[model samples]
Target chain A: MIPALGLLLGVIIGLALQPTVPLWLQPYLPIAVIAALDAVFGGVRAVLDGIFNDKVFVVSFLSNVLVAALIVFLGDKLGVGSQLSTGVVVVLGVRIFSNVASIRRHLFNA
Target chain B: MTQIPQTPEDGRDLDVQPSTRTAWRRLLRAASPRPTKGTLLAGVLAVALGFAIAVQVRQTSNAGLEGLREGDLVRLLDTVNQDNSRLSDEIVRLEVQRDELATSTDLEQARAAAQQRLDALGILAGTTPASGPGIVMTIRDPQAKYTAAMLLDALQELRDAGAEAVQINDGRVGASTWFADGASGAVTMDGRTLSRPFVITAIGDNNTLAAAMEIPGGVSETARRMGGDTTVLIRDTVDITALRPLSTPRYALPENQASPSK
Candidate 1:
């Protein structure tokens, strides 16, 4: 409950601030966001499955974002940034969809 | 024959089983570590994700000017330079006219001759608006194989057809216009990257232009053979709204005028 309240507070504060991201980091932000989305859905699925470990969740979330951005960065260096970004998005999007499907089943039991 | 039970499942052993879902669930269980209590990690991630999404959305919405790449910036600067040169030339011409009026004993004849020359030069130099019956052609590349060379060929074909003025998409073509290969199988004309389904509008004699382009063994037929489509329409009047900048000659003077060094 406390964590959820903290999350809500953070969201409100972030929205209110409306901070602009730095130009250098703009390219990576998109992949990072998609990775973060995948993690969010996974976290929700874990919570429903009674396996929502704090360490695991934090580690997975950080790893997802980091690995995704890293792949895109390396792709840019190799002159294939868009192709790699698409790959990352495809995998993450599939995972997110599956996790969300499971979450829906858990919620409505349908 | 084996007697099937009333229930969906039969007593006899079957190859297919309904336990695949359970297996998948077990796999999920093995992957996710079970915790005694809910962690703060999920909340933190949720907050970050929300913030990032909001920021990304806003950024994309405001990305019009900022999204231009280095090449686009260079092209923009080039266009600005051209405009600057054109305006300065006009200023110099006006100043020259002022000097002539002040110095000349007969202003009326000189003014009339200067105005006539300016009018004629304006048309030849593409500095004035030209409107007449012309043709509009749509060229579409279904397979991204159309290159800058192909575009040049088409432009030449139109020129050969006596096209006075031509505009492709929004960029106007002048005598010195050239096409360059753009990134990702695209073509760039006059510093602008043209998208698929290039619409070329040319101002000239409608029937002659159409006949020249539609001649057997022509650019249109070649485009069709290359897995592309071409549609040509001869309109009564098409506006040629593009202006070409005129650069003043510095080192080169008229043949009659002697150089300072000489």
Candidate 2:
């Protein structure tokens, strides 16, 4: 409930401000969003399993965003930014899919 | 209870079970986190992540270029660049045309001034008609002393006296006119014969021109000494009605061009 409330507040503020991301950070934002998506799915699954930890959820969210961005940045320096981004997306995609599938089953009791 | 083996060491479970269960429950309570008012940090991080995602989505769609391929973006950039350069070139061309129009108005005024000066010169050279206050000198050369040299000298005197236009015996005297004496005191001016009693018309200041020829030992005196009659009259207006024919230069070119040495 707190996460949902927080998400709503952030969306409202962002819409009102319309702040531009800095140029150096622009390349990482898409990857970070995907990483955040993975973390949200994991958090939802944990909540369903009755083992949700606020500390763990917050730490995981931060590390997911940071590591995803860092990987892309390093790959860019190494001239393989697109390939690394693809790899990261593929892995996060599978995790999010599995988590969603579990959430679906848990909610539907199927 | 039935699955447990009844051994001598396992008999302690019965005695220690309640206390150990309470300790384990205390540890679980301490380790697991529930969302309380103190979970502000987690909420804030979640908020920040949500904000970033929303902003990224907005940025991607704001330009109306969502879902465009990379090649399409490059092509759009090229078309925009071409438009910019074409506009720049058009501005430069218009500026140059504006400058030319501005200077041409000034050039037109200068050309009018030059044309006026040229007309004045044509009058003075006797290639055009002129009317002004001047003196008319009538000469009766019964003694036939108004030779070609004397006629030429008279023209020079009138020129020195500021005569702007001149005619002698119905012939317009120009810069290149010549006099040739014929038989029995007859005169040929510009290949046209003139009978005796020549009338010379000159246009200038009436007082100065009359005084010029009337001066002692002037052209009038020279004429009198040659046994010829000379009469000077100041008039309100004199018309040197004859006009010289303007010739187009055939051999002479503009000075800027190289010419063969004579």
Best by DockQ: 1
> Ten consecutive residues with minimal summed lDDT in candidate 2 chain B?
B1-10
Off by over 4 Å in 1: A1-4, B1-38, B67-109, B112-262
**TM-score of every candidate:** 0.45, 0.40
> How close to the true structure is residue B5 of candidate 2, measured as C-alpha lDDT?
22
Chain B TM-score (model 1 vs. true structure): 0.53
* Candidate 1 TM-score to native: 0.45
lDDT (10s digit) by residue, model 2, range A1-110: 56667788988888889987766777788899899989988877665555667778888988999999999889878868888989999999998988876555444423
lDDT of 1 by residue, B77-111 (tens): 89999999999999999988777767667688688
lDDT of 2 by residue, B187-227 (tens): 78988987778788888877888788877877788888888
The positional error of residue A105 in candidate 2, measured at the CA in angstroms, is 1.6
TM-score of chain A of each: 0.88, 0.94
